[model samples]
Target chain A: METARISTWQFFILALGYLLGTSFFFRIGGLISIAKQDAWMIPLWSGIAGVLLVLIWIKLANYYPGNTIIQICIQVAGKGFGGFIALLYIGYFVHLSALITRNLGDFMKINLMPRTPIVVFHVMFLLVICYAVTKGVETISRSTEFLFPLVTVTFLLIFFIALSEWNWDRFQGMFHMNIWTTMKETRSLIGFPFMEAFVLMMLFPYVKSKNRIKVSFILANVVTALLLSLGVFFTIGVLGVTRASHETYSLFVIVQEMHIGTFFEHLESTIALILLIVIFIKLSISYYCAVSGLCQLFQVNNRSWLSISLILLVSGLSLGFDNILENIVFNREYYFEYMLLFAVIFPLLFLFLTWMKKGKEKRKVVGSQA
Target chain B: MIWFILFIAVALATSIFMMVKQKKSTKEIMLFSTIVLLGFADWISIFLERKFNPNHWIASFIDWISL
Candidate 1:
């Protein structure tokens, strides 16, 4: 008897926040480094592919309403095998949470505050996450509903503000490069930002409306893609390819230069402050899913009991990276492939079986009618 | 390290207290405590200069297979 407390609207905002969270700030430069001027278009194609990927989850979700990916896994496969698979998913989410925390900690240490111990930022953020998530998933969604509007307004405001520095000449050589080859080179992006939305399957079951759930997520994916693509487009236009590619945060580099008359100079921290909250929303979703899945696996009634432990667990793990370069290197070389099994293979098998089962049921009904 | 230990002790005490107060099953309580203790031990190990780096493990595994 699970009650759905989140509206499709909140679900859309949560998806936007979660998908864009740490990546827009941290991962954009790497994309720029690979594709140069055409980096802007990568997310668009990635968005289309992401839609196809999410469609599988949507169909599975529709087949079994009110049940999470974890529950569905346990149902479709036997308990021992399925439960073990579900546990792996939980562990994956936990690892993702740790990575997101490390991303923020690394960002802050490198760019914002160098002297403070990284653990302070990790623990502080994790503490807030622990508190919010312990209240339950609906609390996370409701808070996302409240704060997402401000993120949007600021996003738009920064967009207009950055437009003043745009130069079209930077895009001069863009059309010469082959599109198919570019896509092949930068395909890892599809995994990092788009396919990774597979994790949202955990949140999909909680959306109050069933029919239009696909629209909410597909629209969010397209919108986030557009926003991110626009971000890359503007970064190249303002800073050019070489400069944008080198900086850790190409968009933040653009923001740092936004000087409206005399008043709003050095807006990097301002943008950082907003984006850090977006990252917080992202971490909370992963944290909630991991905790909820673990609780489900263990049959623990009060999920909050595990919250404190997970904070320590994630924080400790987050500090494992000696610095940002190794983290970036790991992500570039291997993160996507590592995510392949969970994001693609498992869901495909689940949908195939469910479809087969549905077809058999339909055939049985037809025979009875005859 | 002392403060970290104290924080863990207090956290464990309160959570287990609440679990017991809510009349949760002993199995649930044990599982919760075990995870928390595991996490606490992990953190303490980090501060003691003996870190367990999962990224290393994952990366090496990926490399091992790639070869």
Candidate 2:
């Protein structure tokens, strides 16, 4: 078991940063395209469901106090099956790291560095992430204490400036979609941004205050969902649904629209920098989880080799996607379902097994006492 | 491609320098060396632009299942 412990505040900020991650930059358009004006509601509703999922995760975490989800799997499902599940999770975390890295590279290529090869950005960022992960979770979480405030203040600045461009008409037809369609659109939110918090289960054992874990996790989700919803709401109000849906980076587009008598005509780059910082924190956390999870699974005491290897692997794999469009399409069509199974369905099943095992142990104790 | 190679070299050198300074074990060194070798193999494949791409493979697997 890893002995590193982070403060509850650090864990809270880490969760918030991870939840915001690439979603801040890339996910809004998908939501707007699906829900139109009602896209903001997706996060609010999904956040409630996210809280339930977090509760289940917390229960499982408390049940296996010092063990990660990987170890929990081994304990709950037995050796062979649990190891298979753990391996699958390892793949999931690594894949998630790659996808987020690609997202960052793609965002930079499109908005900021159109001339530079995307691979360069991937390599550079992964180098930093590789270094951070080697320093362990505490270091990453401490860095977020600075980054989270910077991102929040910058995001708020963009939010307030974009208000000048908001149009009430854009919010028309809010409930035009049927219930089922609305719910379907929300799966993208729930599965991708929200359930991605499931990765935090790996870090739960590292949090100092186990008793406060559930509250911090849920609070972090609420704040992230509110921020995301506000971002989407502002995008639709400023750009309208049609324009917002068509644009890849709706927040970037909105920030580009900010104009204060020609003085602040070009703030998109500044805003993009803020988004990049938040996404970096997000990617670093996921990268750490992936590398450390592998270390735990392999029972490797020295994580330096494994961390560098996985970082290289992820950075290289991120270049596999032909372009950002293919990645977006894949996320919309398939990635959520994949994440949902592992993040939500599998955890619930694990919880059920845990309950059953506990019941059996209780019965065994009672029979012994008798 | 040259920049890619340079970046990888710098990253590996820095990582090794840190590990050695921190006195990481021999097993750790061996493992890190193996990963660096694997990274070089990947770089060669990427330079060659081979059709057997892991990225496409994973994407295709997800695509196939989602379909």
Candidate 3:
């Protein structure tokens, strides 16, 4: 299979889109509920932690220039154990993609079309994602680059407009510290939007500018952190922590409250449009990763068949969730830890083994030269 | 139920079309068939009065082991 190469800028856009995707819609309420008025600080701290994980991924990518995480695992752990680990990672990606699909389906069912069956949303969305994946990563990355700027600008516009309704007193309790609570909230943040950046490692081999991978990673993280922190800040300021925490989709509520001199009222549709774009990019990337991982795992030369099949599988799986509330609870409670295990703990272990192996090979080379 | 059937039909049609166009290997065709069949089985499980939720099962397993 010929690897599709994407420019660093496109790669950065894809990362930013992935980070802002569902997290922009769903994370604020949980963050506010946990951190209260100080929720705004969580993204900044979590973004720093995310960068450390990115550094680990970059180190591993530098070690093996053209290999995906699955290949890297096979090289590090030997074929049998490494293949098992690779399957686990593939499972994690597929599961994560299904949840994101379900989340988007549920969001639309609840907000945009209450009368429509959730499966309709899931199937239609998955069809689009399947098409995008079959076209390859360069197509997805290029589309993300074109859409990223528009989404960012619209998101910031909504943020600043919501600032009109901001009450300065919401920051009153900002300085009041709750060390344990903040730390607990930070764990979920890191487990989610931050640590989830590790999925981008699968795309590292596809990045055209190898040396600028780190720069693109850092830039994407910083921009995402700023955007998310400001989102929390605006949500708390406009709605207050109590209201923000109580609302399921706080950003939607915030956008609804934007009046724009009474002429441009009820911009929830515009907000919904933005949400759809970001979520589409995020889901497409996840679908691509999962399908591509399966191709690599199963040694399938043609991915179109598997891509369509997996799309159906994911759409079907998304319907398996009992309800939106259950989905939310599962994500906040279980999904984070599940992702952390695969994205962090396992990768770190593999990186250590790879390092030891490199050292041994280096010593052998030195001895041979002597 | 009708929607489920329609979705499955479309999926099957696409799989067949792709297999013919690309001349997919036997392994690829078999994998596609298995996935499509599994998806259909899962969809029908709802009507069979079975509470089949792989998502919840996995989540419960994770929660159990973590505990």
Report chain A TM-scores, every model. 0.94, 0.96, 0.95
lDDT tens digits, residue span A1-370, model 1 = 2344788998998998988766678767888888887788888888888888888888888888878889889988869988989998998888899989988888788779999999999999999999988888788888888888888788788888888888889888785567888777777787788878988888876788878789999998888788788777878888899998899887788888789999879888888788778887999999998888887777777777778778878888888777788888878877777877888889888888888888999999999999
Q: Estimate each model's TM-score.
A: 0.93, 0.89, 0.93
Taken over the whole model, the C-alpha lDDT of each candidate is 0.84, 0.82, 0.83
lDDT of 1 by residue, B1-67 (tens): 9998998899789888988898999978887887787788778878888887777888898889889
Q: Give residue B23's lDDT in candidate 1 (0 to 100).
A: 95
For candidate 3, write residues B1-25 as lDDT tens digits: 8886887788688867878788877
Which of candidates 1 and 2 reaches a greater lDDT? Answer: 1
In Å, residue A304's CA in model 3 sits off its true spot by 1.5
**Fnat per predicted structure, each in turn:** 0.58, 0.32, 0.58
For candidate 2, write residues A225-329 as lDDT tens digits.
888898888888899999989999888888887889967789888987887788778888888877777677667786667876776677767776678778776
Error of 2 at A347 (Å): 1.9
DockQ of predictions, in order shown? 0.65, 0.33, 0.58
**Deviation of model 1 at A156, angstroms:** 1.7
lDDT-sorted candidate list, best first: 1, 3, 2
Better of 2 and 3 by DockQ: 3
